[model samples]
Target: MANFIKIIFFLIIVGGIGIYFLSQSPKIFQGSPQEKVSAPSQTFVSPAPTSYTSPSLSPAPQAISDYLIPSGFSRGQLSPYFEKINISASYAYSHFNPSEIKLSSNLSDNEKVNITGWQIKTNNGEIIIPQAINVYEPSGLFPQQDIVLSGNNYVNIYLSVNPINKNFRLNNCIGYLQNDYVFSPSLPQNCPTPSRSEISYLSGQCQSYILSLWGCKVPDKDSDSFYVSIGGSSEEEVECRAFLDTIDQNGCFRKHRFDSDFLSNEWRLWIREHILDSQHDRVLLFDKQGLLVDEYTY
Candidate 1:
């Protein structure tokens, strides 16, 4: 009986030690089958700035044919070249210097020419901004104003694409043509070009002066810009070195980005930083008092 009792005690001690060890172990090591290990969470890292994916080029080309304006013919003069549009949206117009238009004595030579009467021709129709050429920021920039308002104190007027784009629009669809990269040194090597046949965004537009004037001409690769330059006879003619087309998108992109592309360097950097910081993004904020407090992603 003594021997049996000693054996039983030994067994009990061994069992208790086993139980304690088991208790101290992780649940997976214990006999319970219910324990599980979860996957580790992951973080995302942005690719290098040069990691831009090659834009696709498989889209069918848009059909456009060009008819030249004879060298002797005057442009906007014979064309009556204003396509009508109303750009007076409350959000669009701000810091209106009526003084600029009223011919303020304080205006500089550059400031004296605010691009008021110009109409931007688009595939959707005409877009007009009464204050284009003079202001630091044109009302046309408002389409992307969310981006501008997000990080900038003030965006330059040249950043406004709608007033200049051949498609009469801005946003993702807007990108530079081959020429814009040439003349506008500010445009990066990767300035977005159309990968598809139906290029959507354009930098700006000009009117064809009713179907009768140029008879539906468009810009080709060699085309340059639109201007109301003094003709050989000294008459102002609305002309582009290459004629532009709104409907078919010929001569459809800007050879040069806005002359003001230099002004937005800080703004561009701010946008990039915001994008980098974005797990998601927000660009604007206001105090309860209704004044803008911060913009761009915080």
Candidate 2:
């Protein structure tokens, strides 16, 4: 009985030690099958950090071109004189000076092309090329002619109000209008100088005064010094005044209207306001049939 009791005590001590070790181990747990699921591994998955983005505040780019070039129309080919016409790369596209676009014709072209009804398109707007008088007559009524582009000719299109009510061809006499109206690109003041034959009938003093006068200029009758410089009797002064009157545009037109070289190679066309962009622009030229003639970008 003593030996069996001692063996029983030894067995109880070994079982107590095993129970203490099991209690110290957290991973080794005594529980139901459902609880033994290892607590789903308790991995900290800090919900994928929410990402954010900001919106852009800038404006989108502006689209300049709207029309497609016709298939047959290519540079220097496939149309009547379209190839000979060109838009100058240089521009007066500013707010300070009058906005201007220049179109030129090749010097080698054999035939003249009428550009009336042609269209010039820009980023801001479009304009129809209008008819202008081929030769300007300072008459009460003026007729309109097609805007013709002869060989080595050019046109200056101004985006400003027309000084004259209608567009007209530049002439030697047109420079006289510079006194009354302002031309953006000033008119060519190349009027024919008066010869001695014009004043040979007058007295020496009167003849010298008349010959000394500039072409395309109206003597300043308003100035007191004008009469002093003329140094003539009232009757003679009347004759001088009459002669001076003939030096104006109307007078010049009357004198040189029949001359073959009277007309200039340039045309000045005025358009409505706000037709061009001041910062940058793409200019396009289309013929009467809306075929592309030329394009210029700046």
Q: Which candidate has the top score in lDDT?
A: 2
lDDT tens readout by residue for model 2, 1-298: 9999999999999999999998876666546465645445576767888855221101111121223343434433323434467775344554336778889887444456778999888777888989987787777567898887767889988777776767878888888888888766677778886778877776676676666667566777778376455655577777776776676778788888888999889888887746566667788888787766777777
Please give the CA lDDT of all the candidate structures.
0.27, 0.71
User: What is the per-residue lDDT of model 1 for residues 179-239, given as tens digits with 9 covering 90 to 100?
Assistant: 3322121322322232323332222332332222222232342433333331223212323
lDDT of 1 at 159: 18
Evaluated at residue 111, the lDDT of candidate 2 is 56
Q: Which stretches of candidate 1 lie over 4 Å from their true place?
A: 1-173, 177-185, 188-288, 295-298
By summed lDDT, which 10 consecutive residues of candidate 1 come out lowest?
81-90
Instruction: Report the error of model 2 at residue 24, Å.
Output: 99
